[model samples]
Target: MIEILSPSEITRARATGALVGRILQTMRERTQVGTNLLEIDEWTKDMILEAGAKSCYVDYAPSFGDGPFGHWICTSVNDAVLHGMPRDQVLADGDLLTLDLAVILDGIASDAAISFVVGQERDPEDTALIETTRRALAAGIEAAGPDARLGDVSHAIGQVLSVAGYPINMDFGGHGIGTTMHQDPHVANDGRPGRGLRLRPGMLLALEPWIMVDTDELVTDPEDGWTLRSVTGARTAHIEHTIAITADGAEIMTLAPGASS
Candidate 1:
C-alpha cells in the first residue's frame, strides 16, 4: 500500500526517523571488537523502549524469512548484508558491520541502515564498498522528488554502483514505508528512468542501496534463515535512509542532527 502522510503524520514521521537515526548511530558507536552480536540487539531493544516506540522487525515474519524475526535489530557482519539475525559471535577488529533498524513512533514507522568498520584496522576494499553504497544512497535520495518516477531514483542509485564496479542485487531493495514497515511502490536498486510509480508530496520511501563485492548473488544462512550473505563470501556494504517526498524535493527523515549529506 502507498501511504501519504498527513501533516500531523509527517511530524510524527520526523520524530520516528530521528529516533531510528539516533539508535543506529548509537549502535554503530557501541559496536567494536569483542562486542557480541546479541549485545547489539540488546542495546537496540533498550533504546527503542526508552523512546516508547515499537519495533517493526521483532515480530516481523515474511515469506522469505523463516518466521517472526524475534530480534530488535539486524546485525549483519562482514559477508552478511541484509536481514541478518543477531547471533552470539563477537565482533573482531576490522569486521564490516551493518546495522538495519526500523521503529514506529506515534504510529509512524521509519527505517534506516548504516555500514561501518569495527575498528581502526580498515581494509581498503571494505572502506570502498561502504563508501560506494553511501554515495549510491545519496544519489537515490537526490532523484526522489515530487512528480519524479521511482525509476529515476533507481536509475540514479544504479549509476553510482555500476560506476564503482559493484553488481546490483535485484532480489531485495527499497520500498514505500509508513504506518507499517514495508509498503508498495517497490524501489529497485537499478531500473530504467522515467518509468514506474510517480512520486508525490507526502509519500514516504525507504531508499536503500546495497552491494556485494564480487557478485550479485546471495545465499541465505540455512541455520538462521534470516541473514543474507554474499554467495562468494566477499565483503559487502549497505546504506539506507527513510525519505519523505516534498513539493520541492526529498526530505531525508533519518539523518542525525547536524549530519552532513
Candidate 2:
C-alpha cells in the first residue's frame, strides 16, 4: 500500500527520522576493530527504548527473511549487503560495514542506512563503493518532489551507479515508507524516467542505493538465512535516507542533528 502522510504526520516523521539518524551516527562512532555486530544491535535497542520508539526490525517476520528479524539494526559487513542479522562476528580493520535502521516514533516511521569502513584501514575500492551509493542516494532524492514521476528517482539513481561501473541489483531497492517501514510504489534502483507512479506532496520515501563490487547476484547466509552477501564474495555498500516530498522539493528528515545529508 502507498501512503501520503499528513502535515502533522510528517512532523512526527521528522522526529522518527532524527532518531534513526542519531542511532546510525552513534553506532558509527562507537564501532571499531574489536566491536561485535551483536553489540551494535544492543546499542540500537537501548537507544530505541530510551527514545520511546519501536524498532522496525525486531520481531519483523517477512517472507524474504527467516521470520522475526530479531535484531534492532541490520549489520551488513564486507560482502554482506542487506537484511544482515546481527551476530557474534567481531569486525576487523578495513571491514566495510553498513548499518540500516528504521523506527517508529509518535506513530510515524522513518528509515535510513550508512556504510563505512572499520578501524584505521581504508581500501580505495571500499571507498568508491561507499561514495557511489551516497551519490546515488543523493540523485534519487534530487529526482523526487511534488508531481515528480517515481521512475525519475529510479532513473537518476541508476545513472549514477551505472556510470560508476556497478551492475544494478533489482531484488530490493527503495520503497514508500510512513507508518510502516516498507510500503508500496516499489522504487527500483534502475528504471526509465517519465514513467511509473507520479510522486505527490506529503509522500515519504526511503531511498537506499546499494551495490556489490563484482556482481549483482546475492546469496543468503546459510546459517542465519538472513544476511545477503555478494555471490562473488566481493565487498558491498549501502546508503539510505528518509525523505519527505514537499511543495518545493524533498526534505531529508533522517539527517542527524546539525548534519548534512
Candidate 3:
C-alpha cells in the first residue's frame, strides 16, 4: 500500500525511525570479533520490548521468505546480502556484516541498514564495498524530493554503484514504508529517470542500494530458507535509510538523534 502519512503519523514515524537508528547504532558499537549473531538478535529483541515498540520482522510471513521470520533483525555476512536470518555463527576479523532493522513505534514503522567491517582487519575490498553502498544510498536520497520521480532516485543509486564496478540486483530493493514495513512504490536500485511513481509530501521511502562484487545473481540458502547469498560467493554490501518527503525536500528520519547525516 502507498501511504501518505498524516502529520501526526509522520511525527510518530520520526520516533520509530530514531529508535531504529539507535538500535542499529548500539548493535554496531557492541559488535566485535567473536560476537555471535544470535546474541545480536537477542539484544535487538530486548531493546525493542524495553522501548514498548514492535518488531516488523518477528512475525513477518512474506512469500519471499519462510513463514514468520521469527527474528528481530537481518544479519548479512560477507557473502550474504538480504534476508539474512541470524544464526549461531560468530563474527570474525575482516567479516563484513550488514544489519537491517525495522520497527514500529506508536503504530508507525521505520527501517534502516548499515554495513561495516567486524574487527580491526579491514580488507580494502570490503571497505570499498561498504563505502560504495553508502555513497549509492546518499545519491538516492539526494535524488529524492517532492515531485521527483522514483526512477530518478533509482537511477542515481545505480549510477554510483555501476560506476564503482559493482553489479546491481533488481529482485530485492527499497520500498514504501509506513504503518507497516515494506509497502508499495517499489524502488529498484537501477532504472530509467522520469519513469515510475512520483514523489509527494508526507511519503516515506526506504532507499537501499546493495550490490555484489562480481555478479547480480543470488542463491537462497536452504539452511534457514531466508539468507540470500551471492551466486559467485562474492562479497556484498547494503545500506539503507528511511526518508520522509516534506515541503523543503527529503529528511532522513533514520539518522540517530544527535548524529550527523
Candidate 4:
C-alpha cells in the first residue's frame, strides 16, 4: 500500500532512518578481512535491541524469497547483490560487500544500503562499481520531489548506471517504505520519465539503484535460498536511501547523525 505519512509520522521516520544509517555505518567500520558474516549480523542485532527498535527483516517472509530471512542484516559479498543472507563466510581483502538494513522505531520503518570494499586491497573495477551506485543513488534522489514522478527518479538513476556501462537488474528495485519495510510504488531502476506515480509530500520512498558488471540476470544460491548473485559472477554494487518528500523537495532521511552530507 502507498502511504502518505502524517507530519508526526514523518518526524518519527527520521529517527528510524537515522538509526538505520548509524547501524550501517557502524557495520562498515567494524568489517574487515577475516571478519565473519555472522559476526556482522550479531553486532547489528545487539545495536538494534540496545536502541529499543525492531528489525524489519528478521521475520520477513515474502513470496519471492525463502521464508523468514532469519538475519539481522543483508551481507552481500562480492558478486552477491540483494537479499544476501548472512552466513559463516569470512570476508577477504578487496571483497565487495553490501550491507542493506531496515528497522522500525516508534512504529515507523526506514531502509537503506551501502556497498564498499572490505579491505585496503581495492580493485579499481570494484571501486568504480561502488562509486557508480553512489552517483546513481544521488541522481535518483535529485530527481525526486513533491512535484516529481517516480519514473523521473528511475530515469535519473538509469541514466547514470547505463552511462557507466553496468546492466540494470529489474527484478528488485526501490519501493515505498513507511509503516512496513516494503510498500507500494515499485520504483524500477530504469523507466520512462513523466510517468508513473506522482510523489506527494510526506511520502517516503526507498530508492535503490543496483547493477551487475556485465549482465542483467541474477541467480539465487540454492542452499541459501537468498543471496542474489550476478549470473555471470561479475562484481556488483548497490546503494539505497530512504527519502521523505517535502513541499519543497526531497530530503534524505537515512544520513547518519553527525554526517556532513
Candidate 5:
C-alpha cells in the first residue's frame, strides 16, 4: 500500500530514521577484523531494546526468506548483496560489508543501509563498488521531489551504475516505507523516467541502489536461505536512505548525526 504519512507521523518517522542511522554508524565503527556477523546482530538488538524501539526484522517472516529472520540487522559481506542473515563468519581485512537496518520508534519506521570496507586493507575494486552504490543512492535521492515521477529516481540511480560499468539487479529494490517497513510503489533500480507513480508530499521512500560487479544474476545461500550473493562470486555493494518528500524537495531523515550530505 502507498502511505502518505501525516505531518505528526512524519515527525515521529524522523526519530525512527535517526535511531536507525545511529545504530548503523555505531555498528560500523565497532566492527573490526575478527568481529563476527552475529555479534553485530546482538549489538543491534541491545541498542534497539535500550531505546525502546522495535526491530523491523527479527521475527520477520516473508515468502522470499526462511521463516523468522531472527536478526536485528542484515550483514551482507563481499559478494553477498541483500537480505543477508547474520551468521558466525568473522570479518576479514578488506571485506566489503553492508549493514541494512530498520526500526520502529513511536509507531513510525524508517530504513537505511551503508556499504563500507572493514579493517585497514583497502581493495580498489571494493572501494569502487561501494562508491558506485553511494553515488547511485545520491542520484536517486536527487531525483525525488514533490510531483516528481517515481521513475525519475530509478532512472537517476540506473544512470550512475550503468556509467560505472556495473550490472543492475531489480529483483529487490527500494520501496515505500512508513509505519511499517516495506510498503507500496515499488521503486526499481532502473526504469523510464516519465513512467510510474508521481511523488507526493508526505510520502516516504527507501531509495536503495545495489549492484553486482560482473553479473545481474543472484544465487541465494542455501544454508541461510536469506543471503543473496552474486552468481559469478563477484563483489557487490548496496547503499540506501529513507527520505521524506516535502513541499520544497526531499528530506533525508536517515542520515547519521555527523554524516555529511
Candidate 6:
C-alpha cells in the first residue's frame, strides 16, 4: 500500500530515519578485517533496543525469502548484494561490504544501505562498482520532486549505471516506505521517463541502486535462502536512502548525524 505521511507522521519518520542512519554509520565504522557478520547483527540489536525501536527485518518473512529473516541487519560481502543474511564468515581485507538496515520508531519505518571496502582497497573494479551505485543513488534522489513521475527517478538512476557500463536488474528495486518497510509504487532501477506513479508531497520512498560487476543475474544462496550473490562471483555494490517528498523537492531523511550526504 502507498502511504502519505501526515505532519506528525513525518516527524516520527525523521526519528526513525535518523536511527537507521546512525546505526548503519556505526556498523560501517566498526566493520573491519576479522569482524564476524553475526557480531554486527548483535550490535544492531543492542542499538535498536536501546532506542526503543523495532526491527523491520528481524521477523520478516516474504515469499522470496526462506522464512523470518531473524537478523537485525543485512551484511552483504564481496559477491553478495541484497538480502544477505548474517553468517559466520569474517571479513577479509579489501572485501566489498554492503550494509542494509531498516527500523521502525514511533510507528514510522525508514530504510537505507551503504557499500564500502573493508580494510584495504584491492581491485579498481570493486571501487568503481561501489562508486557507480553511489552516483546512481544521488542521481535518483536529484530527480525526485513533487509532481515528478516515478519514471523520472528511475530514468535518472538507470542513465547513470548504464553509462558506466553496468546492467540494470529489475527483479528488485526501491519502493514506497512508511509504516512498513516495503510498500507500493514500485521504483525500478531503470524505466522510461514520464511514466509510473506521480510524486506528491508527504510521500516517502526508499531509492536504492545496486549492481553486480559483470552481469545482472542473481543466485540466491541455497543454504541461507536470504543472501543474493552475483552468479559470476564478481564483486557488487549498493547505495540507498530513505527520502520524503516535499512541495519543493525531496528531503533525505536517513543521512547520519554528521554525514555530509
Give TM-scores for every candidate, taking all chains together and pairing residue i with residue i: 0.99, 0.99, 0.98, 0.98, 0.99, 0.99
- Please report the TM-score between candidate 4 and the true structure: 0.98
lDDT string, candidate 5, 1-261, tens digits: 999999999999889999999999999999999999999999999999999999999889989997899899999999999999999999999899999999999999899999999999998998888898898998999999998999899999999999999888888999999988999989999999988899999999999999999999999999989899999999999999999999998999999988975
Please provide the root mean square deviation of candidate 2 (C-alpha atoms, Å): 0.6
> Candidate 1's residue-wise lDDT over 1-261, tens digit each?
899899899989999999999898888878888999999999999999998999999999999999999999999999999999999999999999999999999999999999999978979999899899999999999999998999999999999999999999998999999999999988999999999989999999999999999999999999999999999999889889999999899999999766765
Error of 6 at 36 (Å): 0.4
Candidate 2 whole-model C-alpha lDDT, 0 to 1: 0.93
lDDT comparing candidate 6 with the true structure: 0.94
Over 13-44, each residue of candidate 6 has an lDDT whose tens digit, in order, gives: 99999999999999998999999999999999
Q: Model-by-model lDDT, in order?
A: 0.94, 0.93, 0.94, 0.93, 0.93, 0.94
Q: What count of clashes does model 2 give?
A: 0
Model 3 residue-pair collision total: 0
Return the clash pairs for model 4, or none. none
Assess candidate 5 and give its TM-score to the true structure: 0.99
Candidate 3, residue 96: how far the Cα is off, in Å: 0.5
Count of clashes, each model:
0, 0, 0, 0, 0, 0
Minimal lDDT window, size 10, model 4:
252-261
Against the true structure, candidate 6 reaches a TM-score of: 0.99
Lowest summed-lDDT stretch of 10 residues in model 6?
Answer: 120-129
Alpha carbon lDDT at 21, candidate 6: 93
RMSD of each: 0.7, 0.6, 0.8, 0.8, 0.7, 0.7
Pick by lDDT: 3 or 5, better one: 3
* Residue-level error in angstroms, candidate 6, position 84: 0.4
